[model samples]
Target: MKILKSTLIATTLLMGISCKTSNNHKAQETGLRDAYKNSFHVGTALNRDDILQTDSLRSALIGKEFSSITAENIMKSMFMHPEKDVYQFDMSDKYVEFGEKNNMFIHGHTLIWHSQLAPWMRSISDSTEMAQAMESHIKTIVEKYKGRINSWDVVNEALNEDGTLRNSAFYKTIGSEYLAMAFKWAAETDPNTDLYYNDYNLTNKAKRAGAVKLVKDIQSKGIKIDGVGMQGHWHIDSPSIEEIEESILDYANLGVKVAITELDVSVLPNPWNLVGAEISQNFENNKKLNPYPEALPDSMQVKLAKRYSDIFKVFLKHQDKISRVTFWGTSDKESWLNDFPVRGRTNYPLLFDRELKPKAAYDSILALKK
Candidate 1:
């Protein structure tokens, strides 16, 4: 009897250990970073709360799941350089620290952008003064985090929907030369870091052609343009796989890497067929627009899963040309989609839901690895 009891106890202990080990293995398989570890760096943008560690769940999820991180807003000019002389490094400092702690590939969001320009910088009309401000802005930010940031969006959204330059303040003040000037300053500031031109709607033929021309122009000038960022602010139905794939190949053909930056698939219906990610565009809230205010229905959830799976399929097919795929946010609750293009409407646009639990979309994306 004593021998039989001892054997049973030993068997029970071994079974417990086996169960724990299996659970851990399953968890590892589900992580985004681990699922695509061999393919590319899986990444997400970090908000201020994530940087401060105020929300324990978000902080932990970011550290565990993403292999790269982009500052969602803090690194932008309005936030980083609110005044000519004032440089806010507190939040951005914490951001880089978090990335370093997790051994993440830190990507500086933007060195020059027209949307969030400070008033002082925007009001400068003289070409020389504008050039000086642009150089100072790019060099100051780039020099501060020179070695720490592995890559940068040297310029963001400089082109319009019709493939011409947007005539932004930079363009109006300094002409189209500002594009090359921005890349040049960033390259000079940090020769070791990768510099990229980031924009939206590269899938459109006209915009794609414009991007090709832009990159080729920079390259022709002997500038070190490393990659192009196709902002993946997509919807469930639009931007078919063909467009995405074609855009990827076209950008790669430029002899520069392609990154799917700011990726998020909005599941909500497009209000008046919204196409671009212009933040100023807004529509009033109503039942017709904000369809799933309470909860995402089962059918919609399945649709979202299929959307994500199809998207990842494209990413995997051309993983060689792709360097990183960074989701715009970590979870649905924190996604910018919740506010942009519409206001105060519940939108489920991420792999994780509001409760910080992985949804069907997450499972579907992980299954692609098999």
Candidate 2:
């Protein structure tokens, strides 16, 4: 990694256009958490394996660079509450403990979602039973982490691209109104904690309109809602800077905070021209799409760095409306990109590489001061 020379880049940003030298050298010493501490929290999603401290280097990096923690999968429905009468807390307990020990802003990944539905939950044949099950699940989990977790994604990926409800089991049985009920139930359980409706393709006009409607409908009914998480599952050269910034302002207008949740910039080529990050999609891998299977070329690394820098510049511009920007995973190797739309394709989509070393993108992001 090269020190961003004090003259060319640093001076230009830190000192201004007067060609003066900056005395704010402390920015060089602090990690990203401090760099953007005043603007918004810098966070990353973690798994039990990372929290257990299996890799001392990665664990240390998490503690140093980030000020917020979110469970990548443990807090999901399947892993947290897998049975009708059973609830698993071993991993979640550890995750909370880790957050407390590190003084991190702990965030629950999700509470209600059409995906990752518990097997027993799927067997419900009546709307009444399904509603009861949803209420019970939210109450139990929210009560357990009442004061532990800071905020929650009350629902995840619940809207379609056309601004209508995705016909998942919950939407089909209980209808779009079920989304409101879900937030109400969560608020009843833990009114103090923040609640958000998180989804992908949030920058798209139709999808964002649907989200804004959900928030307005809930608030109009006197239900508690805190934020709308715009999952930044993006690729290079797409989702232009103007588009993302526009989405931020739009979500901010809904009288709720906006979060860039599940953020990662995939460098690999796409198998097909897809838009949002849906886990169900997959295609056979081709070498053209999986070009850099071993290492990212220098030119691509620079591109990745600039991409992140440009995004953060937008985040800084909308600090009042934004609460947090969380990377989808800790490192490139752990990123779900490898097997999502294809199988066994390496990707460089995170600040840290496979070995957990900070990449050029990290430095570029740090160079961006608030």
Candidate 3:
């Protein structure tokens, strides 16, 4: 009897140990890069802290899950060139180094953007002066990181929702030729790097048409525009699977690689059906707008998972044309949606929860690979 009891206890202990090991192995194996290795490059945008390796958990997760990285803010015009003559390369330098250390496909965000322009650049009214300033800004930044940076969003958000070019400061100053000029400068600066034009709401019919025209016009000039980045800032219900697929095919037809850039599916309600990622748009936070404040209900979690899975199915169907799919942020805790359109709202827009644990959406994405 004593021998039998000892044997039973040992069996129970061994079973527990085996189960624990299996769980640990599963957790370590949940990597986006590995699952989508054959399909396309899986990437995520990293904030300053992530690039600096300040948050060890985030740093490790980013390194393991993503095969490519984009600087969320450090490489933007406002941050990189805040002052006219003063270029802040410290943080951006660290950003490049982090990508190099990880052996990631490092993509520079924007060489010319209307939104985050420096005060001096935006204030330039003369055509010649504006041209010189723009040239200096693009040449200096692109030259400094010429060989190190792999690709760039040469110009971002240059079109309006109605399929017309936005009359931005660059446009008002340098005329419509500025778009072609920006790409020309970037191409001249780095003949090797892939240059892309990025923007939001590109899935919209009119906007997509505008992008098509924009690409063709640049190519007509014999300039190198390698891809068009469709910023996938979608809601759980929006941008039907058909529309997503159509946009991919449309952009692919243009002979430029398609990239799903700045992707995040928001599960919260838009205050007034607000569309597009205009940073200037904001609303007062209230209970109705900020639902799921403390915890996301199980039903919503499942819905988010389904949304991501369906979207990836479209991506998988046209994998040959797609070059990269980069999530805007790493985890829900760091997601920009939480604060955008509405402030102080808890948002569950990413595949990882606040604790940095993989959510159901992450599992669903991985399951598609199998």
Per-residue CA lDDT of model 1 for 1-370, tens digit only, reads: 9999966765664444335334546645568887788999999999888999999878888888999999999999999998989899999999999999999999999888898888889888899999998888899999999899999999999998889999899999889889998999999999999999999888999999999999999999998899999999999997999999999999999989999999999989898887769888998888888999999876676677778889999999999999999999999999989888889888998988898877767777876886
Please give the CA lDDT of all the candidate structures.
Answer: 0.88, 0.86, 0.89
The best-first sequence of candidates by TM-score reads 3, 1, 2
- lDDT, model 3: 0.89
Q: How high a TM-score does candidate 2 get?
A: 0.92
Please, what is the TM-score per model? 0.92, 0.92, 0.93
Give the distance in Å from residue 189's predicted Cα in candidate 1 to where it truly belongs: 1.1
lDDT of 3 by residue, 69-136 (tens): 99888887788888888999999899999999988899999888898778878888999998888888
Is 1 or 2 the stronger prediction by lDDT? Answer: 1
- RMSD (CA, Å), each prediction: 9.1, 5.2, 7.9
After aligning candidate 2 to the native by TM-score, how far in Å is the CA of 142 from where it should be? 0.3
Candidate 2 structure quality by residue, lDDT tens digits, 211-254: 88888989999999999999999988778999999999988988
Task: Give the backbone clash total of model 3.
Answer: 0
